[model samples]
Target: MANAFERLVEKMDRATLDRMGKPVLINDVGFVAVESHLIPEMGPLTGDGISLVIFSSDYKPRRNDQTVWDGQSYIVTRYQSFNGKPQVWLE
Candidate 1:
């Protein structure tokens, strides 16, 4: 059944995320432990933005929040659900 297969895929994705996710800080306050995937091909979705999809089981950063990834500071410009997970667009 398609539903059963979807559930199985979800479980597998969760397991992968649990094993690969790492803790990241937001504005030095909110902490989210998620597996972040970078989208460098978009060439700044917000005209000087960095697009990243974050898979987390607990928290997600809000819009206008700040984070430092790979030693570079970024500003969160957008937050939306992608494939049932959080996708963050930063500038």
Candidate 2:
């Protein structure tokens, strides 16, 4: 079972997303609402990138998974969980 803090965080995350997120397409499965952050420059090879926090219950993303956001296509290059949320990096 999740601890109280974890449950609270989940609720807060959902509320924030519901109010602020935009639609994102993942692998053409369907459109999910998420808050995405754009990084102006990622690195030499990857170039610019987008980062978004997501709940595993909503969608679990893997590396190389295709995503479409703001009318641009990208690939999931990496991800790491922080504070019960997965920070997905798209390139």
Off by over 4 Å in 1: 1-3, 11-23, 29-48
lDDT of 2: 0.73
- Expressed as tens digits, the lDDT of each residue in 1-91 for candidate 1 is 5698898988877786678655555677544345445565945533445556665546565888887665678888878887777777766
Candidates in order, TM-scores: namely 0.57, 0.66
Candidate 2's C-alpha runs over 4 A off are 1-7, 31-33, 36-48
RMSD of 2: 3.9
**Model 1, position 26: C-alpha lDDT score:** 66
Candidate 1 TM-score over all chains jointly: 0.57
Clashes of each: 0, 0
In candidate 2, what are the lDDT values of residues 36-62, reduced to their tens digit?
555447435445456777654567769
Q: Best candidate per TM-score, number?
A: 2
Itemize residue pairs with steric clashes in candidate 1. Answer: none
